[model samples]
Target: MDIIKGVPLTSYILLCSILFAIGALGVLYRRNALVIFMCIELMLNAVNLLMVAFSRYFNDSNAQVFVFFIMAVAAAEVSVGLAILMMVYRNTKTTDIDALSKLKY
Candidate 1:
């Protein structure tokens, strides 16, 4: 009753690629800072998924450990990123990235 054996590695890779691409597009097309941040998280998760998939396929714990580190980094990033975004929003009163262009000074 092994689930991983049923799914090919290529399929996993393809799915990861598609997810990563969607995340990238979201970041590029969305003007809202929150949405962009979410997209970045999506991209990181996609990579994590790929890493886990490969790790499992190769029967290696190293990739799993790497995934744990990535998750930790992502958590820290979320906290710091949200804090910064909150401060920016409080000052600018807007979440639109284009509105922040005045900060070039």
Candidate 2:
């Protein structure tokens, strides 16, 4: 396979995979809601990086378009999520999701 820049395709894929795994681990292990949110962003970024790599390799623009959509969604999600988090903190004085009880009225 032809090299993309100075790096090989296999290396790029492995790096993206590692980034995704780390993000997953962070999301799974973190207790703070903000940290979890950040981890989710990390995962999304990893996916975006992978998509760009594939787009470049295939000489296609579709993947880039998909990535743009992903970025838009992520931005909207962060905005709404932070707004909700602020609301939750204002009501409860905490952002620890484990302390949340959805059944409480």
Candidate 3:
């Protein structure tokens, strides 16, 4: 806690912003579904980091609780998302986003 408090708020904000930007760019530019999914997780992690930083700075436990909820939800999402991705790959033989776009029967 002390280590986190030692760092300035601006530093955390800047780090989160950079992480979010990278995740956003990866989501937008990557063609593979897995890569896009990873980017989405990265974005979520950035938000979580910001939340935890603010909670630590403010000496509040609410944001920390919310972060746990977010992490649990993310875990469930990963299971479901990976199942869907596996099904898509099994059907289309490719994980390309463009390939999925052409999957209309």
Better of 2 and 3 by TM-score: 3
TM-scores for every candidate against the unseen true structure: 0.94, 0.90, 0.92
Q: Over the stretch 1-105, how does candidate 1's per-residue lDDT look in tens digits?
A: 565567899998999999999999999999999999999999999999999999989999999999999999999999999999999989999999999887598
Q: How many pairs collide in each candidate, listed in order?
A: 0, 0, 0
Which order, best to worst by TM-score? 1, 3, 2
Clashing pairs in 3: none
C-alpha lDDT of all candidate models, in order: 0.95, 0.93, 0.94
Better of 1 and 3 by TM-score: 1
| Number of the candidate with higher lDDT, 2 or 3 | 3
Model 2 lDDT tens row, 1-105: 655577776787999999999999999999899999999999999999999999988899999999999999999999999999999999999999888988788
The list of candidate 3 runs beyond 4 A from truth reads 103-105
lDDT for 47 (candidate 2): 96
lDDT pick, better of 1 and 2: 1
Which tens-of-lDDT digit does each residue in 10-90 have in candidate 3?
999999999999999999999999999999999999999999999988899999999999999999999999999999889
